[model samples]
Target: MGEQPILEMKNVHSGYGSIKALKGVSMKVMPGEIVAMIGANGAGKSTTLMTICGIIKATAGEVWYDGKKINKLNPEKLPTMGLCQVPEGRRIFPRLTVEENLILGAFHRKDKEQIKKDIQYSYDLFPRLGERRRQEGGTLSGGEQQMLAIARALMTKPKVLLLDEPSLGLAPIIIQQIFDIIKDVNKKDGTTILVVEQNANLALQAATRGYVMETGEITLEDKASALLENPKIREAYLGE
Candidate 1:
């Protein structure tokens, strides 16, 4: 058999009280690969990440992580298992300084020495964050907050990091910087990533493989390069 996926969702159906946001959504992230899920807003892209993390329960279907059924697992317990998420809005602890916010990402871990090293590594990954390590998270610019959110998530040293809408809002230059760091983290740390993005061009550019979602269902899955060149994707998502 081929290598088992680090994370897999088999026909997961999830929603908020009577609203079925995900309709039989299925996807997989292989080990050490950056798989991007690209879609428009309200396409259930974020819901997929939430369902996998157990923040939103799948009404029907299975979520498998590291060869185990994790659908029923508590969301709070996920971080200890190396499942970390950087949600859409870059939700950092507003009152906390950048360093303190990053420290909290590793709260469940016991490796004191490695945690210190990872913090420095996060700095190296985003020097802008390092420059403002002592500043309150809320005070940073939108792009800086997004960087902090990603950097904080990295502190957990996840086996598969779920990133939701990494390019939501920002200047073009800042968005490029974030995508570059996403590539950097994948190469340097070998961190497996499943990034959910509405910016199909940027997502596919950074990914090795990609899934395109529309109205809560996956309509396309292919090598990122192939998707980029696909005429339909170019028209619908890339705004050709």
Candidate 2:
């Protein structure tokens, strides 16, 4: 097996016009690892993911994925490279049926048989989505919408899944369930995941390793278990 990380960002700086969000942020996600980025609101966690996925142009530094420099690639082409994001706010198409939303994810692929199988796998991963396969995405409850968002991304058959705020606006029980499913997806599919989460305690628990971001920079990174036990991490993020 190759030694390079599935995804790597080196000194990436990006943001909207005249607003720099990520300032020299560097991180990596190795194949099959569930890596979490945790921080408070406006810490630039989502910005890092967007830069890696090519949604926002990196004004400086490099983004490497699967042993290649992809900083200049278009966002539309990243999915074909096995890089996909389940963006924040559960951005499922409100007017589209759950199945249609899923179909949209695989629009780039030509493998009919595998796509069908993956669609069924999504249903298996989220049974509630299957129950409402033909229902409009907007009709689903908050938790269900979150599930659909994740399932839709999975349908792309990504090698690395970038999940931003997967637990946002979710009930505690639903958050637990979502984390469980995320863990299962990583374990079973061997998908490398880079997750930005506000729920630091839960994110650390589910991750193999984690990076703590503050402002526009990465402030701490370690084994998730070690980070969880860190006094500073507990004091600031874990609410202890």
**lDDT, candidates in the order shown:** 0.92, 0.93
Candidate 1 differs from the real structure by a C-alpha RMSD in angstroms, to one decimal, of 1.2
**lDDT, model 2:** 0.93
Tally clashing residue pairs in candidate 1. 0
What is the lDDT for 26 in model 1?
A: 85
Report how far residue 140 has shifted in candidate 1, in Å. Answer: 0.6
Give the Å error, residue 67, model 2.
1.0
Tell me the tens digit of each residue's lDDT in model 1 across 96-124.
Answer: 99999999988888899999999998898
| Model 2 Cα RMSD, 1 decimal | 1.1
Off by over 4 Å in 1: none
Clashing pairs in 1: none
